[model samples]
Target chain A: MISFQKFRIYINKCFIALICLFSFVVLLPFLMLIARLVKSGLKYICLDFFTQTSPSPVDAMLANLAGEAIPGGILNGICGSLYMLTIALVLTVPLGILTGIYLYENRGKKFANLIQYLNAVCYGMPSIIIGIVVYVSVVKSFHSYSVLAGGIALSISMLPKIIRTTRETLKLLPAYLKESGLALGGSYTGVILKIIMPAAKGGLLTGILISVSRALGETVPLIVTALGCSMINWNINAPASSMTLLIWDFFNTPNMVSMVWATSAFLFSIIICLNLIAKRIGRQWKFILYHE
Target chain B: MNKNHILELKSVSISYSPGSYALKNISVSIKPNAITSIIGASGSGKSALLRSINRMHELYPNIRMQGEILLGGKNIMEMNPVEVRRRIGLVFQQPNPFPTMNIYQNVLSGYKLNKIYLSKSEKDRIVEECLRNVSLWDEVKNGLNKNPLSLTVGQQQRLCIARTLALQPEFLLMDEPTSTVDMFCTNRIEELIYRLKNNHTILIVTHNLAQASRISDYALYLEKGELIEYDKSNIIFVAPNDKRTEKYITEQVE
Candidate 1:
């Protein structure tokens, strides 16, 4: 039997080895999926892939060696997604941040306490539930699944994230900052806007970016609400389809599996680009915060 | 020293919660342009006493108080907290210049508090003049737009002093302003305090008796939340009226 002291050392070593294995296990699925996607999607990338969107398996994909004309462009899906996402962001970011600030700044007030509890509950709720609520409340009234309904649902789901992140980011700010502003005769709003927000700008930006990313990737709400048409609708007043629905619809199709892979790759790349951009912007924001 | 008694506290007593006396009934008159030092051991209510002048005591919760803190012949309790604070500038022990602001912005914080529309030139002039008063003009002149934290501790403390001065307050409350600074900063701030004494009524809280003797015109000793003694700084150092003051001086001297 090993002595306790030696056993402790052995345990430490085993812990480190376990961490390595766990990391690999965690990464395995993603790596495998990405690797498979890259390999499968390589043959699909071409001038036709760029110019044409909905390629029939019998046309562009099946007649791989034989050149054939493809119909449609992801242009509609792109436009619809861009349009709805913009509306969702416009609806969510400002309202979410303002609510977050209210919760944090007015902390300990009965209203603030209520808001805190509600925000917490909202954050924990499943996005699907929000989607269904939006569907029943807004979509049903319109008597059809619409992009506006989808966007409203997306905005609702994004709201809790934005509020949670904004609240946490505001909390991360130094307590002395508000005190300093207060000491200087600054009003409560002035202190939050001019001092606290500026100090926590980096963290707040990161939080907002996370919320945006979460909104961008959401599909369940869009599926149940927008029901996702293939055509691009510029006006948020009208029905719209987005990339997530395209990915979902294509992946399920027996004949259109190739197009699904391409769209999947596109969406995955977009998310990565977004994350990188957010990371880069966050770093810059922090630099400005500390050294402005 | 300036002859006007700019601020006064009459029988000011504060408690953190119910029946927890942080400061006992303490009466003191702050003279204009004179550096008055509040000296005591830690938890002796020196900081609390200083905070009461600018209504900083209300910054916490469940803390109750009874006091008539007068500013320039008016009880500040009758005025708005913002109004009282605007008239009395405070410098903390630590050099806490706003990190998000540039050197120039920190000096103009007081004006920004009013949210008054100021011409860019007027704002710039205030920043330059205030920084100049604290003798931080040259070191930070080339970098007015640069962040405040990039400056040395000595420069930061001076910047804080400059920040305080920008409010155009008649009195200044410094809570151990030199304790966190180095000797160079200490000397620099002491000199600045000396220069400031001709204009603003200054109340400083510190455990450093020598510092009290060095910069303060009036020295006050407090113990167990009670006023032990008050006299001219030199007299307090050489021939203190209280045995406790004498013991404090002896301990510091050793």
Candidate 2:
């Protein structure tokens, strides 16, 4: 008969080896995608890529038929994305943080419980469904696909993320911190704003950054609301373009493959830079608050 | 109610839920300008009794308190809890100086929380006076702007004391303030308590019977949820009173 202990040890080793092999298999395609994008994307990047507006797809098609080069840049998309993302962030951050604070302070209350359940349901809702909802509510009401509608849609998608993260972070704080504040004669609002909020600053900022990043790359909501413009537009009531929209639209065209790759690279860099800045700020705040 | 008593608890009973009591019908009067220590085993309601003085127990949604707690002849139950807490400061068991605040800010936190603005010079004077009262001035004088976490556990506890004192409260409630520190810090804190009794009415809850005898002017012994005995500290420590008190004291020593 086989020894039971020996069989158990062999099974554990086999499981470990299998996990390692699967992890490497998962990592290989991701590394290749990044490498391919960087190699092709580097050559198309130029100062003009960030300085001029994108040409219309019809204009590019006609130029291709006439044996002429398609001429334009992604500046309109970059500008539009930044403007819409800023509006969405402003709309969502304050409301989301306030909701999170209420949930934490009035924990186990009926209204707070209802809100928590609703937030969880909203977080799990698909981005496309949210886009369609915003289309009917804001886009149809305004009688135009506009930047404002797009921003509102993005805000809805990001709100649940910010609220959940803020609540979870605040919940991790020790109970004694609040008690200490009360013992110092602080009112409830005073303790929350001065002590608890400041203590959770790094986590709150991280949540905001994560929400911004997610909103920046979102495509489906902007498609249904903003409807993609080729010209640089400053009016919030007018249709606008974004990097993700540019990539989605241009990739399907026969001659605009290079444009799509370049926009992808630009989008990748923005996300990387944003995350790096967030991590650095978190480290600095932690060092100042705790290590010193 | 005697005018000499700064705090009086009359038939006070606390329960977290129906049909159960954490502190049952406890009554005691604390004299002004004296240190009173409440000594009991764990789960004997020492901390609960102390929290009732500053209305800290009301923070919980399920807690129920009956009867009256009078502060200087005024019923604390009828008073605003924020105002009552301002007049009666508390120090917790663990050293919890606001981790985000510097020493100066931590000391001035009471003023800031109450929205009581002060001139820069006034703030400076208050910080110095409060820190000195806890005997932490010389050690932390050079690093006044440093984070409170940079200090040792002992110093952090002292800083918390200074933070409480900055409110200029009439009574100071300390719940096992030295239980988490070293013996040397314990001795120093005990000495500070002794000195502070000259100006402020102090109520402390401690599990250490020896500590109660060492620093308190009066001693209260609690068993389960009942007040078994209370008298002058020297008499309670030296003379025999209740059999439970004697047994507990001897058991601690042995």
| Best candidate (score: lDDT) | 2
| Candidate 1, B1-254: lDDT as tens digits | 33335677799899998788989998987666789999888998999888877888787876787978777667888888888888788888878888888888888877776787789998988888898899989888999999887888889989988998988888888999888888888888899998998878899998777788888889988888999898998889999988999998888889
Kindly list the per-residue Cα lDDT of model 2 for residues A103-178, writing each as its tens digit: 9988899999999999999998899999999999999999999999989989999999999988987886767889
How accurate locally is residue A267 in candidate 2, as Cα lDDT from 0 to 100? 89
Displacement of the residue B18 alpha carbon in candidate 1, Å: 0.8
- Model 1 reaches an interface RMSD of 1.9
Per-candidate interface C-alpha RMSD?
A: 1.9, 1.5
Per candidate, native contacts kept equal 0.65, 0.88
Against the true structure, candidate 1 reaches a TM-score of 0.91
Superpose all Cα atoms of candidate 1 onto the true structure and report the RMSD in Å to 1 decimal.
3.0
Clashes per candidate, residues 3 or more apart or on different chains: 0, 0
Residue pairs in steric clash, candidate 1? none
Where in model 1 is the C-alpha error above 4 Å?
A: A1-15, A42-70, A106-111, A284-292, B1-5
